[model samples]
Target: MMIIKMDDNQKLGENDHRRLGQELDLFVFSDLVGAGLPLFTPRGTVLRDELLRFSEELQAKYGYQKVFIPHITKDELYKRSGHWDKFGEELFLVKSQETKDQMVLKPMNCPHHIQIYASKPRSYRELPIRYMESTVQYRDEKKGELAGLVRVRAISIDDAHVFCTLDQIEQEFTTIMNMIKEMYRVFDMKFRARLSFRDDSDAYIGDAADWEAAQRTIEEVTKKLDLHYDIAEGDAAFYGPKIDIMVTDSLGREWQCATEQLDFVMPKRFGLAYVDSDGSEKTPVMIHKALLGSFERFLSVYLEHTEGRFPLWLAPEQVRIIALKDDANILKMAKDVVKKAKEMGLRAELDDDNETVAKKILAADQMRV
Candidate 1:
């Protein structure tokens, strides 16, 4: 519901990310590898890694601990998390030949993270345990619905979770909002908030009182932060209400890239608890968040937004030293420059190709080097 102006200088035919991705050689899809699966080339991986590094760096500043989990898990995990019932049709089932176990490619990471939290008993002192991971999740998408990186079977998420007491919910959410704001600011994207709360739908889990409480908390924090947001009824996650960060791209299009959800359901379902000062077990509130919801989707929006003219810090080829002449001294000078740039932690390259200077410059410009 939020509107903003962007650079609409790109012509109609130039804003297609699929075409731009091909022209830039960032990624590819092959029939043999199947559909909805994108293979990131070396150049594309540089872009991916740079974004991930930035995300991790921002989270690390806020005391978010890094965590890793397997790509596949037993089907029971999702069942316990309520995802199996909600998204069972989108699951890719795996049959094990060695045993009678029903396995699945994980559709999400929350359940796996919950297992890690439940591995040990927790105390009030250890409240607000924040865990983060940039990893891939799989889904069985309909072939007809697949398009470029926008809709893919393999999704790379900058996912995180926070387990905290009710008293800490506001502070935790505020910290996450600050992180999201800083990230979008660096990306030069304009965004607004959407308070996604459940309507009178039977699809959502958790008690009515719990849902009301979570939604109230989100609204209170949003107002406290002075964010411009609209109430989006029926857009809530099945288990909780969320603050969906809707980003406006250069083409004046809005994409939901980041989110922070308040869940009083998952922790109770997983039996996650902490010992309070009163010597009683209390359920911790779970916050599911993603700064960049899906790397592929974000890149798709960003590629068109900047027309592949990435910022210097994020450019795969930050510095290109082109040798204008075939002389040994010129080549050595170009190579030395590249070496110096690399030593300074830049992505630099020397283009000492056997071609005309004009042609080399044209190639560099085409590659956005």
Candidate 2:
């Protein structure tokens, strides 16, 4: 395990992304843009795009189709999903001027994704319908709760939903677990499972039989995967039981990074159904997934985890070619090298700045370029 030490900081010091973001010129915050929102620089956006593609690539392997949802939706949708009552003041309501439409910035993507799944009549053959979306969602957070990237009002969420039949629960769950496993393996992240099951609480918004059955399915799948997990009662989302992936960061602090929830509520709430073999109508089960949770928070954790020394594949500035002398011919040759590297799909750049070779080398070394 890598340990990072720093001075004069909050929970994160030298490894703090806020500190590193300034030093590395990755992102910036402005008073005009408000406190919680941040503007990602070209470099920071590279980090974001790279990580987003990585997750999407892995998800594509499981037949998960790309999806898009509006940042704002009609207030009635959340009211139907029960999120309006649950989230209450935490929601960012957008009032209409031209019409009587009361809109709110979406706090979650599952409800919208459910609308897509419920749009058409499905059959048993389309048992496991999967949809993936990497987008932003908004929430009205308290002033005291805001942080740099970890906690903010605007969140870049990598959210997905799987509408599958109850019989196909294990298969779909395993598929989602495999996706999580592959991501953790790629980042060399160690994680344990907290099977967030519901206690006998009224707050849990589903039938008791459905809750117990879903919990059993998760337990069986965990055993099948040979994963070391703990059952956490009352840790479930109001709508369902879930598997939360708790990863150990470089500071030895455990953060809940990913979640795969088994929901029997959302689909039913939206009146989603499919045709069974016997021509009976049935509601499909829902799996709400946040593969890396929030992108900003994940990047913050990853920034600390790697200490900003990103792997060759994950690095924003993979290579920096510097000339030995201030010779046009030498610089031209270096540019050619950079062109070849770029052709080879490497993030490469030529250091043609009016600086000494020694200074260039020192700067690149310090920047992890």
The number of the candidate with the highest TM-score is 1
Could you give candidate 1's per-residue lDDT for residues 1-369 as a string of tens digits? 222322253233556888788889999998899999999999999999999999999999999999999998888899999999999999999988888799999999999999999999999999889999999999999998987899999999999999999999999999999999999999999999999999997989999999999999999999999999999999999999999999999989999999999999999899999999999999999999999999999999999999899999899889889899899998898899999999999999999999998999999999998
Using all chains and alpha carbons, the TM-scores for the candidates as numbered come to 0.95, 0.94
Task: Sum up the clashes in candidate 1.
Answer: 0
Question: Model 1 residue 57 lDDT?
Answer: 94
Alpha-carbon lDDT, every model? 0.93, 0.88
Candidate 2 lDDT, tens digit per residue, 1-369?
A: 232443344444676777788778888888888878889998899998988888888888889899998888899999999999889799998888978799999999999998888778899998788899999988888977888888888899778998888888899888888889889998989999999988876777868898888899999999999998999998999998999999988779888889999999888888999999999998888898878999988988888888788888888899999888888899789999999999999999888888888899999987888
lDDT of 2 at 366: 78
